[model samples]
Target: MRRDTRNRLLEAAEGEFTAHGYPRTTVTRIAASAGVSVQTLYLAWGSKRELLRGYLESALAGDAASPEDAITRFTGLSPRERLVELADLVGEIAERAATGWRLYRDASAVDPDIAADWDELQLLRHRLIARVFEDIPATALADGLTPKAAVDTAWTIASPDSHDLLVRRLGYAPGEFRDWMARTLTAAVLAPDSGADTTM
Candidate 1:
């Protein structure tokens, strides 16, 4: 049950982190939430900061799948299908990590190790997605949609953590905005190769 205990600590920590934030959250509170002692938390995760890292990593992991694995999951699809899958994942991740990410990102800025790990993870994600976008069947048709630019642009609309605004504020459902995002990114990235002016 070691894995179970670790997961319990993590879940407890996530809740505490979300409620009190990184600076205010204490290992005692998190352990209390998990029905464990402060020492247990320290032994399990080393320190409060490490516990926070574990929480952030766990939350981030959901959204951190490589673009290729994501595309493969949505398999037997055309380039458009792959593109849609990629966009959908962005929506899923942003929706879930909306709150946790805000804290994780802010906390990382002050901690070199966390910041480095955060940057590396993000860079890996960007490159992986860019590779997929670059290898689309119509790469040569891209007018100016280089893999780098396409990846940047995709991250642009999808990475803003604005899905809630689009839905709750603007009144679009999750699926609606997700569809719009997919279509929009595909157009931008593919229009160049197709010689079509489908940018929005």
Candidate 2:
């Protein structure tokens, strides 16, 4: 029952944060939406910042395993296949965490409390792409770009912001966006003459 209440509060908080953004969402609004008292919310999460953290954590708890496990899973794929797999994986993550990501990113500029989390999230994202880059063969990378540079490029193109621009703003369907990511990564980051093109 206690866990259920906590989940309800988190759900309400996520909805509030998504709708009004973190700066405008308040504990009272979340509490009322959750059908719980403000005190209950406070007891469960300590502060609105904590609630936001909880929401982000829950959103990121997708089907992925630990970093070690992910590395092991990617180890067997060929370089081109790894890039494709990484694009698919990153797309799924961005899709799941898009709401929280936007909320934290928007709030981080003015909210000192959210800034740290936002920075940490960005670091985590880069690290995930770095791991994928580690699996890619050195020969597969575009000329004149180091592994670090390649990883940075992959992170930028695969980001939720780009996904939102293409899918949400330009009206590309989710599958088309995913396909575009894989193709773009292949052409832009992989070896020259790889035959991958941005046709979609």
Name the candidate that leads on lDDT.
2
Worst ten in a row by lDDT for model 2: 191-200
Clashing pairs in 1: 141-192, 141-193, 142-192, 142-193, 143-192
Which parts of model 2 are misplaced by more than 4 Å? Answer: 65-69, 193-200
All-Cα superposition RMSD per candidate: 4.4, 3.9
Per-residue lDDT over 60-117 for candidate 2, one digit per residue giving the tens place of the 0 to 100 score: 7665554445565566677677778887776776677878877877888988868988
TM-score of each: 0.78, 0.89
Residue 4, candidate 2: how far off, in angstroms?
Answer: 1.5
Runs of candidate 1 exceeding 4 Å displacement: 62-68, 74-76, 138-142, 160-172, 192-200
